[model samples]
Target: MTVTTDIAQRQERRERLVLDHFADETRQDFDAVLATFAHPRYELIPGGEVLDGRDPVHAYYLQTRRAFPDQRHEIIKLRHTEDAVIVEFWLLGTHRGPLNGLPPTGNAFRCRMIALFIFEGETLVCERVYFDSLTMIRQLLAGVSPEALPQVLSGLLEKVPAQTPAVA
Candidate 1:
């Protein structure tokens, strides 16, 4: 096969791997989820804490699984380049466990997200993610504390630093 075809095939596999990780996370399949990442430096960008290694990634997944027991990601688009894949997606779920210290409200929520996956050969080395903060706040507020929505939204934005380091 030509180099171009090989690159395309690798890109497609990388994209599928990313989607599988999200799906496994949503399903509470922690082991399956953790296999997709590279060791010692598997990084998730755009707000979620950076995990240094496989163990940390596993720990983070445990926490998230506890928080979002019913979460599921729906992919809207997948675009590939030679070294990266861009994914546009939406997450839908019910808040049934603790999330960022917020108590569960059992409220259903939806949020849109976009992520760029950087691949090193067939493995994903990093993921840079973007999502709508406003939508997330709205969903988290559903049936709980509408009056405090403004404050919650403000806090969310404040947590995002003014300057985010670029993903390599």
Candidate 2:
């Protein structure tokens, strides 16, 4: 194949891998999701969570999905960089279980997220996510009124600086 054709084919394969990851996640097919990665890893930016290796990444998937069993992504835009695919997506899910020691309030949340599907050549190495933590937190917390949201967010933001959690 020509160099240009080879590059295009590589991009196609990379994009397919990412889309299959999304599909497996939406299906909650954890094992299938795990298969898509050459190096299983995730970084939840707002939550300061980093899970690397198959076991930890599996546990991280379990924990988060346990909290939001219906969690799924809607791809809004996807652009390829030299080493990563930048995805702007909507993450939607309902609070169906305890999250971070808080009981579920049955409320749902929809948040826009930007994530990098990082790769070493054609092999996916990481999925790093960025989003507003406070918005999701507020939706999960019962009795958080629209009027009270600012105060609620401010309180959480204040506490954020105190804890630097190390993810396995």
Candidate 3:
């Protein structure tokens, strides 16, 4: 095969791997998702969180899923690079469980995000995700009055579970 053909083949393999990973995640098949990676790793940009290795990555998955049981991604675009596949997607989910001590708002959120699937040859290495945390937070807190803002924030800071959500 010519050099160009070899490069094309590698790109196709990488794309397949990425699509498979996303499918597994959508299916909530964590084990299958883990198997797609050479090493399970994630970099959550907004939170400055780095979860590396199988255990940490697995925990991260569990935590996020608990917070948003119906979480799923809608792919907007995919661009292949020499060392990464950049994906633009919409992450949609309903808040259904506690997140960082804050009770579920029962609100749904749709946030646009970008993730770079870094690779080594055909082996998936890491997924670095970028999104605005505030966008999701704002959507989750849609109908709170300006006068109640302080109380709402204070309650969150105190880790108090509000009986009613400030959902839209």
List model 1 lDDT by residue over 3-105, tens digit each. Answer: 9898777876787898787777777887887677665344444454466667877777677667677778888999988778888988787877866556666
Top lDDT prediction, candidate number: 3
lDDT of all predictions:
0.71, 0.83, 0.86
Candidate 2 residue-wise lDDT, 1-168, digit = tens: 899998888889999999999999889899999998887999888767778899999987887798799999989999988899888999999988766555566888888899899999988989989999877776677576678667645654554433455344
The model with the greater lDDT, 1 or 2, is 2
Point to the candidate with the largest TM-score. 3
The estimated TM-scores of all candidates read: 0.78, 0.83, 0.87
Q: How accurate is candidate 1 locally (lDDT)?
A: 0.71
Error in Å for residue 135 of model 3 = 0.9
Instruction: Judge candidate 1 at residue 52 and give its lDDT.
Output: 65
Instruction: Tell me how far candidate 2 lies from the true structure as C-alpha RMSD in angstroms.
Output: 4.0
lDDT of 3 by residue, 23-138 (tens): 99989899999998988988877766677899999997898899999999999999999999999999999999877655677889999999999998888889999999899889
Error of 1 at 109 (Å): 1.0
Model 2 TM-score is: 0.83
Candidate 3: residue pairs that collide: none
